[model samples]
Target: MTTWTAPAIDRRHEPYRADERTMLEGWLNYHRDTLLLKCAGLTGEQLRTASASPSTLTLLGLVRHMTVVERSWFRQRFAGADLPELYDFDADPDAEFNTVDTADAEADFAAFRAEITAVDAATAGRDLDEVCTVKRRDGTANEISLRWIYLHMIEEYARHNGHADLIREAIDGVTGE
Candidate 1:
């Protein structure tokens, strides 16, 4: 029985000698891949293992959550694509994180990859200064820029990648940036 493992994150983010968009996209992609790299070499159940009691976080959950995030920011918000969220928020808030024990990790991984491609397509040929109206969590809307989205996504990945580090360590005793 072969256990599924996350692919290696071999590419490094661009540090210098790149334009603004190139640098931003490069960093974001690095973080995005970092999340998957953290899950490499783990079975679906292992990816579903929570770090500790009372926490529903798992690698699969993170994949689902980030998929939604990418869809929201790039497709829905930026591109003005009208679409419902991937997960049901009314019936089950935090469903992405809470309901991953039986979730298909490979499928979610594929979906995440697809969403990334879609996001890239949505944002391509757009200006960083181009602003879009985003509904905030507090029910207030504000005009935000593509640059902000890129930065927010980078930070989001960084934050989740931190969680991923701990989860991976707990799962198989593998650790590193």
Candidate 2:
């Protein structure tokens, strides 16, 4: 299996004139870039292949799922906009994995990239302390701070990016580390 070298973190240490907003933006950018790096050079079949038993998740599915997640959290929840869900939650939430088949890699990447662009546009000029209401999975509504949402998004991407690292490594004997 290939090993994955994590993306560089130089931006974390660099000085920025902007305040917390600048720092948060830097972190988000780092994670997003790393996610792309992990997907680089992978074939569509490789991207969709399951790693092992018990989990059907793949790098492509993660990309799809993350796009949905980013859109949900930032675009809908934070922006307080009534956006249509990307994937049908009525079906399996894991549909991203089960639905994967041989498809155009470029198209998949483009869809995922579009989600990122939407998220960035929705979040532009928003302050960290901004509050928004989101419907919880349990059908309860709760107010959440944008700062917490940003932090959670970063954490979510970071965790899934780790999965991407492993899945990409397993597909080929390429070691990034």
Candidate 3:
């Protein structure tokens, strides 16, 4: 059986001098691309291989986890779309990060890209200060702004991309931005 290999990512440079919205989105996209770059040219097995001992984190798992983050924050919370978790998250909270053993890495990456596209479309023309109230799993409502969402997602991607960097390095000694 042939394994899926990650394709190359063309990462764009984030602008240093840009408007607030542009800056936030650019950084978010930059980090997103960075994650893919870390996975680029790697086979499915390599992508799914764990990092150091005692940590099950994998590049494929990071991609899957980010997919859930994009979908949940933008579509489900911000746009109020009635969407279910893509990875049976409720049944297994870490399902997205732990179920890479048999996961189709190519399909997971595709779904991640699709979620980003959908969220971008769903948020187009939406103002940064536009606020939405989301009910937490505990049934408490909290208000969030598009601005905050962008920043939060940027943080999320940056954190996971760090993990990706280490995982990729462990996989084949490839490292750096």
Q: Which pairs clash in model 1? A: 5-41, 6-40, 6-41
lDDT of each: 0.87, 0.75, 0.91
- Specify the highest-lDDT model's number: 3
lDDT of 3 at 152: 96
**By lDDT, is 1 or 2 better?**
1
Model 2 stretches astray by more than 4 angstroms: 1-18
State the lDDT of candidate 3 residue by residue for 1-177, as single tens digits: 346789999997798999998999899999999999999999999988999878889998999999999998999989999987787767788999789998998899889999999999999999999999978889999899999999999999989988898888888999897
- How do the predictions measure up, each by TM-score? 0.94, 0.85, 0.95
Local error of candidate 3 at 14, Å?
Answer: 0.7
Q: What is the C-alpha RMSD of each candidate to the true structure, in Å?
A: 1.7, 4.7, 1.3
Candidate 2's residue-wise lDDT over 56-102, tens digit each? Answer: 87878888888888888888778877877765678876666678774
Candidates, ranked, TM-score:
3, 1, 2
Tens digit per residue, CA lDDT, model 1, 13-83: 65677899999999999998898888877887798889898888888899899999999888898899998
Candidate 1 positional error at 67, Å: 0.7
